[model samples]
Target: MKKLLVLALVVLIAMVSFAKEQILHIYTALDENEWPIYVKAFEQATGIKVQVVRMSSGELLARVEAESKNPQASVWFGGPAIDQIAAKKKGLLAPYRSEAVEKVPAAFKDPDGYWIGIYFGAIAFGSNKEQLKQLGVEAPTSWYDLLKPQFKGRISLAYPYTSGTSYTVLAALVAIMGEDKAFDYWKQLHKQIHHYNTSGSACVTQAGLGEITVGIAFAHDIITKGIDKGYPIVLTFPKEPTGYEIGAMSMIKGAPEPDLAAKFIDWMLSAEAQSLMVKWNRIPINPEAPVAPGAVKMQDVNIVPMDFEYFGAEKDRLIERWKEEIEYGM
Candidate 1:
C-alpha cells in the first residue's frame, strides 16, 4: 500500500509540471507601458498566463537569433513587419495562418503566413517648443532643417543597430533619396545628434522633458505620450514623404506552446482586442476597430514608397554600413 501511494504521488507531480508549462512566454517589441494592460486582458479573456519581456525590435531579433537552437519564447509581438520579414527569411519564424489574418489587409501581412500586422504609424519629428523658442529657432519643417548649425547638439535619436525606429528612419531616407545620398545625409546629421539612445522612444521622452530640442520617433507615440501628457512638444512631418511601420506579430519557430501562441495572435487581431490600441494612441489594423481621435489617416499623408522585402533582405548590410560610415565616424 505504501509503494502504491508513492507511485500516485509521482504521477500527481508530473501532472502539475505539465500544467505549469501551459504558461505562454513572449518577447515583445511594444512599449513597456502597454504590456501590462495586454497581459491582464489576455489572461482574463483566456486562462493562459502570459510572461512578457519587452525590448526594442532590434534587441528582440538578436535574442531570438541567439536562442534559435534552444528557443525561449513562443511568440514575438509588436514590432515592425519588416523586422518580422527578416526573421522569416532567417528561418526564425514559423508559418501559422491565424483566423484573424482574414480580417487584415493583404499588404499588412506576409503572403506566406509568417507574420501579421496589428497596427501602423508614421515616423515624424517631435520638437520641444519651449526649447526651440529658447534657442530662438523655429520648429523644423523638413529633414534638412535638422542639419542646420543652430540645431547642432540639440537632437536625439536611437542607434540604428538596436532600434527599429532608427532603421525605419534610415530606410525612409534611402527611399526618399538614393542610397548614396542617404548615407551622405546621415553622415551630416550625425553632427547634430546629442546622443544615440538605446531605446527608440527614449529620444522622444528626452525631447518631451526638454533635455533636447528635437527627437525622432513615431508621430502617434509622440502625440500621445509627450504632447498629451502636458509636455511642451509639437509633432511635425518632413515636407518630403515620410515612412511608416506596420507593427506585427509572429510565432517563433519551434515554440514550446504553439497552440497558445496561435490563440494569442488571433486574440490580438480580433476587433475587441485591437480596440485596445486606442489607449496607446496606436492605429489598429482591424477595419472594424475605431481609430484614435487625433490620429492622422494614412490616406491624408504623403507616404514614401517602401520596399519591405528589399529592406528586410538588405537589413544587415545596411546596418553594417551605418555603423561603419555614420556611427564610427561620429
Candidate 2:
C-alpha cells in the first residue's frame, strides 16, 4: 500500500509539472501596441497560453546572452532578422526547420533555420506637416535632403547600438553609398539630429507629436502609429534607395518547452498568422498572405539589397566605429 501511494504521488507531480510548462515564454522586440494582437490570436488558435518579455533589439540580444546557461524564453518572437543572425552567430539559437518554413523565401530566412521571417517593412521619413512648415521646410524626398540648413537639429532616430531600425538605416546607407561616403554623409547629417531615441518607434511618434520635424523610421510605424492615429504626419522615402527589415522569429537554444515553441513558430508562418500583421501595417513575407493596404512593399520604394549575413556579422564592429567617428549632436 505504501509503495502504491508513492508511485501515485510521483505521477501526479509529473503531470503538474507538465501543466505548468504548457505556457510558451517568448522574448520579443515587436512593437508594444502590436504584440497583443498577434499573441491573442495565437493563443486562441493553439489553445496554449503565452508569456512575453518585451525588450528593444539590443536589450533582447543582451538578455539572451546573459541567460545562455539557463534560457528564460523558448522563442524570440519579432525584431529585425539581423538580430536573429547575430544570435545565431553566438550559438544562442536552435536550428528549427519545418514544412511551414517553406512559405518564407531564402532571402528572408536563415538557411539553417536559426531564424525565419514573418513580415517586412522599409525605412522611411516621417514628417509632421505642421512641424515642417513651422521650420519653413517641406518634407524631405531624399536622404541627402535631410542635411538642409533649415532642418538643423530637427531630426531624430534611435541610436544604432540599441535599436535594430536605426542599424538598418546605417546598413542601408552603407549599401547605397560606399562605406567611406556613407561615413562622410553621416558626419554632416549628425548635426541635423536633435536627439537619439532608444526605442525604434519613438522617433516616429516624436515626429508625429511635433517634437521633431522628421523621424527616420520604418514605414509601417509612420502610417499605423503616426498618420492613421491623426498625427498630421506624411510619409516619404529616400530617392537614393534605402533598406528594409525582415521581422524574424527563432527558437531559443535549449528552450524549456520546445514542442510548444515549435507549434508557435509553425503557426506564425502560416497564412493565418501572417494575415494578422496586415492590420498592424507589416507586409507579410508569405506570398500567399494578404498585403496591408498602402503598406510599403519592396518594389514600392527605392531600396538596395542589404546583405543580411554580412551586416549581422559586422554589427558589433560597425557600431563601435560609429561611436568613434560620429560626435554626439554635431
Candidate 3:
C-alpha cells in the first residue's frame, strides 16, 4: 500500500513538471485577427504552450515600461519594430543572438541582437472601392491625392502621440521628405482627415465598413481582413515611395525562461515561421519564405529609404511636432 501511494505521488509531480515546461508567455500588440494564426503554429512546431496577451501598441509599451522593475513576459512579439527599438534604448530588452537570424537581412534585424524582424508591412491607403465610386471620388494613388478636397472628412488615421502605426507613418514621411517637408505635408493632409483614432488597426476596419472612404494603416491589416471577411478594400502605396514597418520579436530583459525565450526567438525568425505569416497576409522579411499569392511583396514596391536608427533617435521630437502642428492644430 505504501509503495503504490509513493508511485502515484511521483507520477503527479512528473505530469505537473511536464505541463510547466510546455507553457510560455508572449506579449504582443497583434489583435485577435493575428494571434490565433501564430499561437496555433507556434504550438504545433515546438509543442510550447503559448499564453498570449494582446494589447495596443501604446498599451504594450506602457506595460513593458511598467513591468521593467520585474518583467513578466518571456518574449515580446509582433509590435512595431520602432517600439522595440525604443524599448532597447531603455534597457527593457535583452540581447539575443539567434542562429535563425542569419536568414534575415542586416537592415531588418537589430545590429546588437535586441530584436529580429519577422515580417514587413507598409503604411498605405486602404480605400473602400465601392464607397469611393459611390461618392464619385477616384481612388487615391498618392499622398497628395489624400489631401484633395474630395477626401475631406473622408479619411481615417491613428493619432501619432499614441499609436506606433501613426508614428511609423510619421517617421517614414520624415525619412522620405525630410522633417520640414513631412510636417508641411501632414499639416496640409490634416484638412482631409476625418479624425485621429486611438487604435491603428481600427482605421483599416473603419475603411472596410465605409465609415471613411480612405484609411491610412498597415497594408497587411487591410489586406488580411478584406481577404478573410470579403470587404471590398483596395490597398495601395504612393508612387513616390512610403515607409514600411519591420514587425519584430525580442526577448524581455531577465526573462524567467531564458533558454526557452531564446529558442522561441530562433523559431520565430525561421523560414518556417516566416511561411506561417502568409496566413496573416503579411510579407515575410526572410528571403526564403515564399510570398503569399496576391500579397504585395516589398521587392516589387518603391519603398522610401528609411533610417530606422535615426527615426528611433528622433521619435520624441517628431511626436512633439505632430502634436503641435496636427493634434493641437497649431
Candidate 4:
C-alpha cells in the first residue's frame, strides 16, 4: 500500500510539471487593466496555461526585433496592424489565416494572411468639458479649430512613431487633406499642443484631469474612461473625415508552439472572441458582432479614405517627417 501511494504521488507531480511546461507565452501591448478579460477568456476556453508579458508597443516591437534569432513568445497580439505589417515584411511574423478572418471586413485583414484585425478604433478628440465650459470655449468640431489661439497650450497628443494612435491620426489627416494641407495643418495645430505623450491612451485621462483641455486619442478610450468616471470629458469627431486603427493580431515566426499559436489566432478571430471585445468597450470589426452602446459605427463616420497598403509602405518615411516636423519641435 505504501509503495502504491508513492507511485501515485510521483505521477501527479509529473503531470503538474508537464502542465506548467506547456504554458503559452503571449506578448501584448495592452496594459494590465485592459488585458484581464481577453486573457481570462482564453484560459477558460482552451485550458492552456498562459504566461503574459505586457509592454509598450515600441518596447515590444524592439524586443521582438532583437529576439528574431530566437523568438520567445508563441503569439504577438493586440497592436496596430501596421506594426504587424512591418514585422511581417521583416520576416518576423509567420503567415497565418485564421478561420475567423472570414467574418472580419476584407479591408481590415492582411492580403497575404500575415495578420488579422480583431477590432477598430477611430481617432477622435477628448475634451475636458469643465475646462472648456469654464474657459467659455466651445468644443472644437473641425480640424481647423484645433489651431485656434484660445486653445494654445491646452492640447496634448502622442508622437507618431512611438504610438500607433498618433500614427493613425497623422495618416488620417494626410488621407483626408492632401499631403501639403496635412503638413500645414499639423504645423498650425502644433502651436496649440501643450505636451506630447508617449501613449495614445494617456491623453484621454490627462484631459479628464483638466491637465490639458483636449487630447487626441481613440474614441473608445475616451468614452470608456470619460463617461464612466464622470471626469467631465467629452468625445468628439472632427467635422472633416477622420482616421482609425485596426487593433490587430499576428503569430510570430518561428514560434515555439506553432500549433498552439495558430489555435490562439483562430480563437481570437472567432465570433465568440470578437463578441468579448465588445464587452470590454472595443468596436468589433466583425459585422456580425454586436456593437457596444454609444459606440460610433463605421458606416456613420466619414472615415478618411484609407489605403492601408500605401500607409504600410510609407510608414517609415511619414514617421520620419513627423519626428522632424512635429516631435523635435522644428
Model 1, 256-300: lDDT tens digits are 889899999989988889888888888899999988888866875
lDDT of 4 by residue, 1-330 (tens): 999999999999999998667978888876566777788898899888788898656566667889999999978888678777777767788888877778777788988888888888888888998988888888888888888777999999887777777878888888988777888889888888898887778888899988999999888788886666788888888888989888888889889888888888888877677787665578887766778888876776778877777776687788888778866865
Query: What are the per-residue Cα lDDT tens digits for candidate 2 across 1-330?
Result: 999999999999999988866889998998898899889999999789999988888789889999999998999998899988988998899999978887778888999989999998899999989977777888999998999998898999988888888889999999999887988998888989998988889987898888899999999988999988999999998888888999999999999989999999999888988888888789998888898889888889888988999889988888887888985433
Colliding pairs, model 2? none
Clash counts for all predictions? 0, 0, 0, 0
Per-residue lDDT, model 4, residue 82, is 72
Error of 1 at 1 (Å): 10
For residues 9-43, could you state the per-residue lDDT of candidate 3 as single tens digits? 99999999986776688888786767777778878
User: How well does each candidate superpose onto the true structure, as a TM-score?
Assistant: 0.95, 0.95, 0.91, 0.91
In candidate 2 the C-alpha lDDT for residue 258 amounts to 97
Candidate 2 minimal-lDDT segment of 10 residues: 321-330
Q: Higher lDDT: candidate 3 or 4?
A: 3
Ranking by lDDT: 2, 1, 3, 4
Provide the lDDT at 265 for model 1.
Answer: 92
- Poorest stretch of ten by lDDT in candidate 4: 54-63
Off by over 4 Å in 2: 2-10, 13-17, 327-330
Cα lDDT, all candidates: 0.89, 0.89, 0.82, 0.81
